[model samples]
Target: MTAPKAWSYSALSTYVSVCTLKYFFRYVANLEPERSFSRMYFGLAIHAGLEAAYRAWKPDAPAPVGVAKKVFMDDLTIRLEDPMIEFKKGETPEGLLTEGMAVLDVWAKEARYEEIISTESEFTVPLVHPGTGEIFERGLKGWFDLVVKDPDTGEPVVVDFKTTARRFSGDKLEADLQIRVYSYAIRQLYGLDRANLRLDVLVRNKKPVFQRLEVSQDSEGDARLFELVRAAGRGVEAGVFWPNDGSIWCGGCPFTQACARWHDNPDALRSHSEK
Candidate 1:
């Protein structure tokens, strides 16, 4: 079986669910899902639009948000999906745009675009496999939405972009394991002890609400994230792919068929040959 290049939230989440499923999907599955899930496409469109707008953003003469959103959706070259590709897709592009519009509108109005220090910065931190000396082989990788400086203090801050239709909540952001992981990676990349993390959540509705959260730096939190990743690495090394209690998210899982087969016909799952 092929091993993962690195452990991230996505992989860790999958590992909790059937390691066999993760192994199959990452190393054996021939047919991949069209989109991540039914609701994911909307976020993708919003991310693309935001990237296009901010990548070319200028503080003096800000680019028109409407124009960027329109051009990104209308122009075939800039779209997330191919114009000519015909298939039974997970979600309609138009539907996603309709849902994402209001949130984007909120973001355009309130976000501190003028304070951007950098955009779309990629960071990779070395990760060691629990049983092997493969720090580079399996490293942590993620993208920071924006790195901006506080106008008052000129302190560097990491900004993460997100959108949700539900009521705003900082509880999740405050406890998010990613914050710690990203904090460690960002600190390592910048060589700073105190790095600021911000969560910019844009709520979707007629009257959208903008929620900004400044995540604190926690050494214990950072240690916890690394421990979780290290545990995952151990699981991968031992070929221990047991399913976690993931029924809450199993509704959206892509390996339901294989999972069902494991229950109904256990022998079929044991067959080494990939279909």
Candidate 2:
């Protein structure tokens, strides 16, 4: 069977669908809002501001430049260098700084900002049925952030970056499934023997944290991906869209009002007694 069109970052519907699915999963799983609002907002601002600054300063760099041209330029020369000086202990010279700056710029601007804009076009990817030879196309396809060749075994490794408000000290974090899904996608697309997946969380309040997991050749990560896909499919099938009440995360969700209304009155009837 022929492969379908791959999902691009430019599509709006895909973005909305992914976000909706994530909200549903979080609600179903009863994820807690562990971080404070101040910390979350601060982390967002810091990440955005840093990215904007990097874009402005590095015009020739492959990284994304922000909408504000002057600010983007100013950030490159001034703000970008400060991090290298303070954090890297002056180890990041001009060349290394430029390279790292370019990488982050692409990540921040293309991966973060441009993704939010709505697009008319949709992208799709092909998934082969396990039992049948039928190839089904799925919407919203994207690649893992990083892929590196392992120095020891010469195998490919998938690395993903995550920005958060705080650090996770344990061997595994709560959202490792996201990385596992990305790794699974990478494996399917590349047809590689196996991928050693790693997650690097850039904690805004402190130093960055790294977590590594070697996905087994067997169907472990694939199972997780299937679970996510099935859960999302079930949500769509059952029309079980409801807001999880009293979840602090609901405050930030765009569909909170719709969910709340639905939860309060699934019949869509207004409360006449209140009036």
Point to the candidate with the largest TM-score: 1
Quantify how close model 1 is to the true structure by its C-alpha RMSD in Å: 4.9
Top candidate on lDDT is 1
lDDT of each: 0.62, 0.42
* Residue 249 shift from truth in candidate 2, angstroms: 2.6
Query: Candidate 2: lDDT of 176?
Result: 52
Clashing pairs in 2: 5-124, 53-75, 56-72, 56-73, 57-73, 57-76
Tens digit of per-residue lDDT, candidate 2, span 1-275? 11124433322222224454234433333444332333233333334444344334443454344433334234434543432123233333353334333434444444322121111112134544445535534533665554555666666665544555455454553335554445555566567655466554554332233333344343455544444454454443454444445655455554444454555565332221122
Q: Report model 1's TM-score to 2 decimal places.
A: 0.76
Clashes of each: 1, 6
Q: How close to the true structure is residue 135 of candidate 2, measured as C-alpha lDDT?
A: 50
Residue-pair clash count for candidate 2: 6
- Over 1-275, each residue of candidate 1 has an lDDT whose tens digit, in order, gives 33467666556656643354545445444436433443444555666677777777767665458755764465423344544333235546565566566666767777545567778887777753334334545677778888887787687788887766665667776566667667767776776776679887776655778788788674546555656676766655554443433656555555556555554644443353322
Worst 10 residues of 2 by lDDT: 114-123
